[model samples]
Target: MTATPRTAVVIGCGTTGTSVALALTAAGTSVALVDDDPGAVAEAAALGAGTAWTPGLPPADLVVVSTAPSAVADAVHDAQSRGLGHVYTDTAATKDIVCAEAELRGCDLKGYVPGHPLAGADAPGRDDADAARFTGRPWVVCPYETTPAWALETVDALIAACGAHRVDLAPHVHDRIAAELSHAPHLIAAAYTTRFADSSEAFLRLAGEELQAAVRTAGGDPWLWGDVLAHNAGPVADVLDRVAGELARAAAVLREGDSCAPLELAPTLQEGRRGQLALQRAGHGRTARDAPAGGRG
Candidate 1:
């Protein structure tokens, strides 16, 4: 069996950090959980995420920073500055800005690997964190060219402990993909949900699976999402522009009462369906690859 990380220091005790800590613990690792607020540390401790941080504690095998995208750079810098672990990593949603910020702030780039776990829940904090949150999920990695081999190995150990599949991508590429698969979708959900905010209860009651799916991310943390969007504005805008154009075309077709073969909306709808199928296939592949050997999944 591949050796998992034996010890880790997880900074930021929010949903992702708490989940990572719990996963690490379940894999027989000793975790030290840290947060800016005493309440957060206490909460994580109560949930058995890990013991609270103490000054001068021995450095661990790895350090995972699961702070919001806005705070990721600073958290990584602080962790490295304090000599926290053998390698430092982050679970920030956006990669480019955070990577640039870390470089601009004179972080130890060779020791830091920026990553994003493509999984989360609407609820925040340790109370809602589950160790299985990252299971069968794609975890994108943005390792600097100068990053050491040991650092990459350290992060791989942590990812293994969490039952996640690792994927390598350049920082800019990661940001672009995240904008399409995550950031822009959140913006669309928020916009869609806001349109019905003033509607009657009966209107809300009419929400079917599709409407609920469309607005699922609308319940996300706005402050955290705002920071993410501000950081990845260019990429998010690029994707949103395409979406907006398609939406306008659909509206125009509806206004002209167009329906039947080769209609304007048909192409758009077909392309959308194709993209959804691609995502479904990708998800199925991940599940199959991660499933236990000879297991009927």
Candidate 2:
């Protein structure tokens, strides 16, 4: 952003979009917040995320989309067709479907870039939209062969503006990693939480910090997560299948309680401990690409 992009059009005033709008606005970029939900638009505007959108507005310098996975392709196509911005990008979790949809629709690819941010809000909607939500987060950018340098830079500008780090990855590799990192974990959380969903208060009293923390993602929108799961079904299913195998093996060992059962579980327990420590260490540091600038609420 040598020119310092002045105006931005943010599509979908959801958690990511609202936060992005607020961060850009705080950085002195005039933002236009658009969403189908009138209440959400009003809420975002009230929070100073951006001005409420109206039709027939002037074209913006950039457009950042944070729409649902199923709607992402059509949204980008429409935005580009309408010349909503000089550069277009999205924060959708799954990239293959959106990119494929844009290609099928013959969308102008010169200004289009695909991205995903690793961090997530504890909840959704305007109430949970934190302008600093992207801080120190790993933001992945998947640029195709034809993706122009300027478009990639434009998105990198947004990532920098949001105080997030930029990571470049191929689309399929990003998808596979995302499945293991996010999609499978969300499903597992829901599965783990469901065991106590209808349990008696007395039975639930046994739950500990580990159980609560592990199932935190169960608090998210089920329908929205289901849509993500459907779009990335292949990779997500593969990860879940592996998880199932491990669980089955553990169950078998517990049930049989053979002489080697303790030895078999020892490696699994030790490996899990190492994984936890690795994740904790990863969280304690900042990536070189993160700008970590001043952010708005």
Candidate 3:
């Protein structure tokens, strides 16, 4: 396992892919940015990222798949068959299924790592690609037992180059945590926002910035979020079930108007407060320090 910087190929050329290409090039790696869209590749190249329309498989020293998780297996298989690179990784939100597919495709697990960055804007496409987008963000790295030590180090280097912190966890653990912390919230936000879409334009105009802020993430690419939620359905379902139970309890409390029931509301309120604090801390990169006093329901 060596740590020499080498040529890299970034597949997809979307915002994430372009960001990765730019980061790798900034780290002194010769990057080959690839995507199905010619315009996207050109746009990335214009930003000083490498240019390549057809990245004839195994990639350079590293091949990064920043596409949808549903497309990861096929991309990994193609890259392996072509001997595209010595190491491969993907920025897919769901990792356990992708890891399973990689094993099924006989990919060299020692040379592969699965990762997801915690930072992204509501905007989509290469036009929004920013090399500094991941700075100070948490980059979750889920590596299998067979993943080479060098591969993990290479990934850590890449994370640092992008000014992101690395958080290691197993694929299943990562998926479950993400479901509770990310997927469920996104679903809630989207649902909340959709309820107002039918309102009159004049009525909607009266909404405050607070309401707009709460639903901002609902504007992200639907297809991308669909692939993510679909791939990790089980974990998301588990969280949703718990949430449903809590909602039911809250409804019961509201209907009865008795705060002193066997199902105490205080504990639930406290937990919700703690979760909100944790979220705020994570968002601010201050997880090691005290969070703000405000809480959310």
Q: Candidate 1 on 1-297: residue-level lDDT in tens?
A: 347888889998888889899999999999998998988988887888999989898888889998888898888888888898878999989999899999999999988998988885565445779999998788989999898888888888888888898999998999999898889999999987888879999878987988887678888788888988999999999999998998887777688874553565677778889999999998777677878887536
lDDT by residue for model 3 over 45-149, one digit each (tens)? 998878674545345777888899999878877876777777788998888898888888777778889899877665565677888788767899988887878
Q: How much does candidate 2 score in TM-score?
A: 0.93
Q: List where candidate 1 sits over 4 angstroms from the true fold.
A: 120-125, 258-262
State model 3's lDDT. 0.80
> Candidate 2 — which residues are off by over 4 angstroms?
1-3, 287-297
Candidate 2 residues 173-277, lDDT tens each? 888998998889999989888878788999778879887887887888887788888888999999999999999999999999779898989999999999989
Local distance difference test, per candidate? 0.86, 0.84, 0.80
A best-first ranking of the candidates according to their TM-score comes to 1, 2, 3
